[model samples]
Target: MSAVLDVVLSSAFLAAVLRVSTPYLLAAFGGLVAERAGVSNIALEGQMLSAACTGALVAGYSGSVALGALCGVGVATLLGLLLAALRLELGADVIIAGIGLNLLASGGTAYAVFTLLDDKGGTSGLKSGSLPAVPLPGIDSIPLLGDVISGQNMVTWLAFLTAPVIAWLFYRARFGFHLRAVGEMPDAAASVGIPVRRVQYTGLALSGALAGLAGVFLSMGYVSFFVRDMTAGRGFIALAAVFLGGLRPWGVFLAALGFGAAEALAVQLGTLDVPPQLVSTIPYAMTLVALAVYAWRRRRQAGVEVAASV
Candidate 1:
């Protein structure tokens, strides 16, 4: 009986880990697109924040989750375009622009919630219709594997499915070749008649749409309402995942799962006979450790490469 209980508990925790990792996967994908196009998209947090507010409000009003998600993505795209115009066209520094956007998101969302929805800090007790669950065909009958792969939110399924497609598009397609060229050497790409600014704009827009998907998952797939600054620094964590994953799709997936597992453990430990504060710090602590590990590996690899070159 004790062994059986242990197995069941482990499975439950694994499920929680997968659930928490979904957003990181999505945001990391977004970062992948932008960074691969030579644009540092530090504005993911702002874009997601805007999308969360839009998704919750639209869902609450129209009572249609799909429409709400569409609206959320639309808003994110517009913001992306705005940022592109400022950074690529108007010569603003991308990093500074991103910081400004994050600050705006933090303050603007709180004000909108209180002034518009009459909520103090969030859209509390509101029902934002949920995205439907998708069961992979024939997978639902495969016992444990079925449960793991099937019956996830639509957004979650999309996030998992899209990663490989994005990877292929980035590396295997003609357009992808162009994107890589822009990222690696913009001057050379421009000499060959490639419009670098256009590529950057497209990448930013795509990144914004992906971030919006993350916001929709938060409001509709995971919860019923939007809370103030609910993303909780997920954007920065996604940035870390992007770099730690070595800018590859599958690598990003693994990084996301690792962090998700840590977060799940933190939540579970909080329930045991442990210090609440210590349990709460576990996830962030894991993140710092993971980053340190990543840096060490990078340095080690660089040393090996230099030694081989010598």
Candidate 2:
């Protein structure tokens, strides 16, 4: 109990949780956008990895984090557009195309990394410019809460703020209404001249941009260097968060935070007798538990609705 409390009470632990969760939060937001538009994007992993490597490579070589971020987001957005084009124009299945893109990204990113860094393993040795952390002005003067909130990466702050923006967009924005309309019933939406395809296309593009930002956060904010396959399937976890959150932005934020805390616990446990392998499973195990709970609640809600109707 003391050990756990020690870990929890440490300001560093809280900061680690925030940092670890940033990418997940960003990716989950992307998932929210994709699903809200009626197109379930499964290519999030590909987009993130592709953009991550590209962003890191650019930042390492050019020493311009901003330009690297643009390249990353642009590449990811283009990938999203390509998927949309494949689905909307070529009559391809979205899932299949997404899966194919993931496979392609694995190989493509590997090649890019090798070409840029002369190594297939990773680019951790590259002199990459990282995103700077912003210290809250006069925040340190406060006692407890200030320690937790101050000195976080600027991207982290932006990521937290993004949740409310997404929530607002879902409830208040005109685009949000169109997204729901197209997602719920494309035929109905199109009959009213809602331009369903255009909406989907735009939604996916936006999703890719968010995913790109997630990638940027991973390579440029969370760490100064890039590791091959560094995302380690967080994209899939974000998808789980999307479903677990019932596709709500704030809900996804909470879910992502849970996963991040689990990850932080795993890292903290590394100093203990726990096997490194077992400690690493904490995040994935939490994801499984979350999914189970989501399923149970969904079923319970459905049962309640049926009983009331009957």
Q: Candidate 2's residue-wise lDDT over 76-136, tens digit each? A: 8998899889888998998999989888988998998888778989888888788888888
Give the count of colliding residue pairs in each prediction. Answer: 0, 0
Model 1, range 1-310, lDDT digits (tens) per residue?
A: 4543454367566666767777788888888888999888888888888888889988888888888899988887777778788888888998999888888988888898888788877887677778888878998787677767677787877887877888899889987888889988999999999989888888889988998888778877877789999888888888888888888888988887777777777776765666888877876887788799899999999999999999
RMSD of 2: 1.4
Q: What are the Cα lDDT values of the candidates?
A: 0.82, 0.88
Per-candidate TM equals 0.92, 0.96
How high is the lDDT of residue 165 in model 2?
94
Instruction: Pick the TM-score winner.
Output: 2
Q: lDDT for model 2, on a 0 to 1 scale? A: 0.88
Model 2, C-alpha of 84: deviation from truth (Å):
1.3
- Which sections of candidate 1 miss by over 4 Å? 1-9, 136-142, 305-310
